[model samples]
Target chain A: MTQPSEKALVPFVSVDNMMRLVHHIGLEEMLKDLADYVEEDFRRWELFDKTPRVASHSDVGVIELMPTSDGEAYGFKYVNGHPKNTAEGLQTVTAFGLLADVYTGYPVLLTEMTILTALRTAATSAMAAKYLAPKGADTMAMIGNGAQSEFQTLAMKAIIGLKTVRLYDKDPAATAKCAENLKNSGLTVVSCASPQEAIEGAHILTTCTADKQYATILSDNMVGSGVHINAIGGDCPGKTELAKGILERSDVFVEFPPQTRIEGEIQQMPEDFAVTELWQVISGIKQGRTDARQTTLFDSVGFAIEDFSALRYVRDKVAQTPFHEDLDMLADPDDPRDLFGMVQRAKP
Target chain B: MTQPSEKALVPFVSVDNMMRLVHHIGLEEMLKDLADYVEEDFRRWELFDKTPRVASHSDVGVIELMPTSDGEAYGFKYVNGHPKNTAEGLQTVTAFGLLADVYTGYPVLLTEMTILTALRTAATSAMAAKYLAPKGADTMAMIGNGAQSEFQTLAMKAIIGLKTVRLYDKDPAATAKCAENLKNSGLTVVSCASPQEAIEGAHILTTCTADKQYATILSDNMVGSGVHINAIGGDCPGKTELAKGILERSDVFVEFPPQTRIEGEIQQMPEDFAVTELWQVISGIKQGRTDARQTTLFDSVGFAIEDFSALRYVRDKVAQTPFHEDLDMLADPDDPRDLFGMVQRAKP
Candidate 1:
């Protein structure tokens, strides 16, 4: 029997392939590109179908599913966050994602999302600050400067034009490491002792603490007016960051309301609490920060569309540059009906 | 410098390894063992954390996420059903899944679920038949026999003592293909012309049609009293197999009620419509087939726990075999904080 000439399956982006792309492109340029992808997707929001993320929680950590579609393609990310894992020598977060064609339901790409997720999270923050923060915001106070700190600095510098960084972590070694990494980048980097000192006079306050409990990283007194608060931690049920007062004072914008409501700072507020979707702001369908003195809060719990956008960017880059391995994952059968034939034909 | 020890990396069960497993165990033994695994998992349903599958719908088809945990471990499957693709010469459904350690939140096994899915779906049906059908029930009318027919036949013979299967499909070629595949089995097979002729005098009725639209493969008038209906195909927003009368007349059993409300025959009913959970029945918390002469329905839209059960089974079996591949998907640094070192240490 003759088989129809089928379209060649796309190459899969693996963990090493993605790392090579980052190394080749330079992390700053890649983060900026990823930021651009997020901004571009957010601007054309109406062309996509959006939904809140679904999560399954346990005592140690949580596994989440974030799914979105750009009308033509569908994507989702599976990520797990276990803060204590760092002590056990495992990264706090590990992820993988899939991109499928909506027309044919064929999975076009499956890529390691660990590094991609880090880049996208930082990119999303930078994208949000572009419209939500004051124009030409220069200095960012990064609280809890750990594994995610450098990416945020790179993204903000490459995308939002940051010139200075103030770092603070409960562990002084982490702050020293952050400072050492940013020492020769031509940007002025300062190590602070307390959260209060970190946020004294910064244009953006990025809180990405890794604590799994409801601990307040930022109080109302520390956050000044006109600063964009990028709340990245407190993304699960019982985990939270910013004090209730910050949420009350700021104009909060979220990726998806239903999801951020449960995972973001809004979890502390009533269900009727008002918020703006970042896509709406990007699409110009809704307003962002109303004035210069208005404190804007981007309560980001990370959405799937950003990951989808990131995946597309990585897939495109992988094609242009010679980096990637075919995963040998998809079962390509000669006869679609005879999936069992694959086993029967295999040589022992 | 020496590369970090490989103790942190997780093992991957690639499609090649899965095919090798099927060849080593042989299809019949694998089907029978998978059926036992599913049956055992169902009986201990109360021990599992069950939730409705999350579904994302599109104009072309629907993609769904099915996740479950048994306190000890968690598993999830990413599956898509685009029935129209077969006409376009693509498989109607394709899937892959992961089984993770709930305590540590690390993926212990990742397996190609396309072929395994076919094996498990048929096994689940036979398991349902074993409990719901009468003591001497030896015949089943399999309507819409396509990719799933042979496994259904073999699983029934292996698990439920089904000695005969009256097969019928709108396409005569499909019916012939099914008979040809199952010719050596002990069960006597008959290819019928229509749904009405197929179900006539049969002890059990199973429907596994593949369409994204509402398809009434079994009508109200065609079903007889004391018949156990295993409805397997109607698994998305607009897809359904049984007539409304069939659902109303039968004692309906379902896999997670919220999910069944969206994907099964019960989707046509209201939010408050009554249905018994198959898990509850299997756990003896509720009853299965309350009456000997009353019609009963197993609205099997497919559940995550069964996949979880199968994943555990496959992962355990694969661990015992030499066929394995190292995906190298995880990022491990001697110090988890030295993520930056990963790039610097890469031997370019």
Candidate 2:
């Protein structure tokens, strides 16, 4: 039987390759590059075909398919979130994604997105902080120092010139892990005993606890008037990290309103609560950080466009690189109608 | 960095491996096995999580993600349909699928489903015919003999004891290719000039034309009483095969009404049009082929559960076999909360 052609092959970046790719391009530089891609896609967000992620919720966790297309390329991520997984020695979130050409409906790249999701989620937070954080902001209060804390702190350092990260988690071991991971990353990592102490003198307050219930990791009293809140953990319904009072006091910015209304911290807010679309803010059609004393909150639920940007970034960077292996994922018959003949010829 | 643990590896069946596996098991035998799986799943269809496939349609083609879970395992197929692709020497339809453990949210198997889809689609049609087709049915009129024709014929032969296949296509070359491919498959092959001629002595008529627009391949007058119609071509909004009159004459059976109502031959019917769920018949809740002179139509748009069944079948069949390779598709950090540490340790 003849070998499959190039068109039939899809470049797959494994977790090992993804980590190698991250190191190949310095981690700090890669985070900044990803932030740029996220910002770029947000600028033209109207062109994307957006849909609320289709999710299958079970008693244990949730599996979701987030899909979006830009008329030229289509991308989607298959991600599962099981908060109980961490107790079982597994990552709470594991993901992989595919990018396909819109013209031919053929996959061009397939890659593990577990590491990429961490990078993109943090980069998106940092990018939002770039616009919403106070001018000359350099300190961030990193609450819930877990898997995402190090990336979040490093992204802030790379994108917004953050010089210090104040880390605090209910589990001190998690805070220690985040602090140790970022110790040599050029940021002054300070381990704090409490969330209140972590927010001291910080310009950005980021919360990313992994509890599956509505836990108030941050209260209204803990947040200062001018500090920007990057809330990334309240991604699913009933999984919020901030108190409802905190949401009422700030101007909430969201990815997609219909989705954010269901999954973001705004799920606690009334349906009529006013919020700004982040794309409009990025495009300069709407205001962002107008006053030094006004609180600006990025109620991020990690939209599909962000993942599309990340997928596109990896696809472009992996071109002609050793970071990917081609898998014969598509069937390419000499005659499109002779698929049976192709299979018959491969009788070995 | 240390090597990823077993939990991070996913078994992947490439196209070559898939073809080898098919040949290893014998195509006819494998088709029969797949039919049994499809039928087995159909019996418990109500236990599945069903949703209309998430589709992203562009001017030229469409990309879709069909996902479902049966409480224990989650499965999804990434498929695309670009009718113009055949002109560029590419298959009009291509697919790949993944099956993940619902408990850990970790993928167990990933496989190229282009060939598998052909096999499962045919198997599903034959499985439906087992319950809907007349007893002692021997000949099948295979119309629009393209990529799916030969599989449909073989599946019918293997699952329903079909002895002869009469082929017809708008393009004679397609019919010729299908006949040539099936010449050695033990079934008597008959090539015909018209669709009418193909059905002269056939007990079952299968239409699988490739047109993206509504083109009636079978008029009402051409469909005789008591003959079973297996329509597998009209899978999108503007695509269909059989005439509206034929649907009116036949008792239509569908996989999922919400999906088939928009993509199947029933799309031409009213929103309130009467149709039976094929699963009900499989579970013995509804009658199949009620009378000798009653027409039965299986409007198969292809559902997520069927793909789920096919994925389960492959994962089971490929176990302890050399038909698949392990893919490092997920990131398994030693400490679930120390993903950054994992990446940092991998800096080579």
The TM-scores of all predictions, comma-separated, are: 0.89, 0.98
Per residue, candidate 1 scores C-alpha lDDT tens digits across A12-51 of: 6666667778889988888889988988998887777777
How is the predicted docking of candidate 1 categorized under the CAPRI scheme?
acceptable
Q: Could you give candidate 2's per-residue lDDT for residues A1-348 as a string of tens digits?
A: 559999999999999999999989988899999999999999999999987789988888889999999899999999999988988888889999999999999999999999999999999999999999999999999999888999999999999999999999999999888888887888888999999999999999999988888999998788889889999999888889998888998988999999999999999988989999999999999999999998999999898999999999999999957999999999998888889999999987
Candidate number achieving the greatest lDDT relative to the actual structure: 2
Candidate 2 — what's its lDDT?
0.93
Best by TM-score: 2
Q: Write the per-residue lDDT of candidate 2 for residues B249-322, one digit (tens) a residue.
A: 89999999999999999999999999999999999999989887889999998998989999999999999689
Task: Provide the TM-score of the second chain in candidate 1.
Answer: 0.93
Instruction: Evaluate all candidate structures by whole-model CA lDDT and list the values in order.
Output: 0.81, 0.93
Give the share of true interchain contacts found in each model. 0.42, 0.86
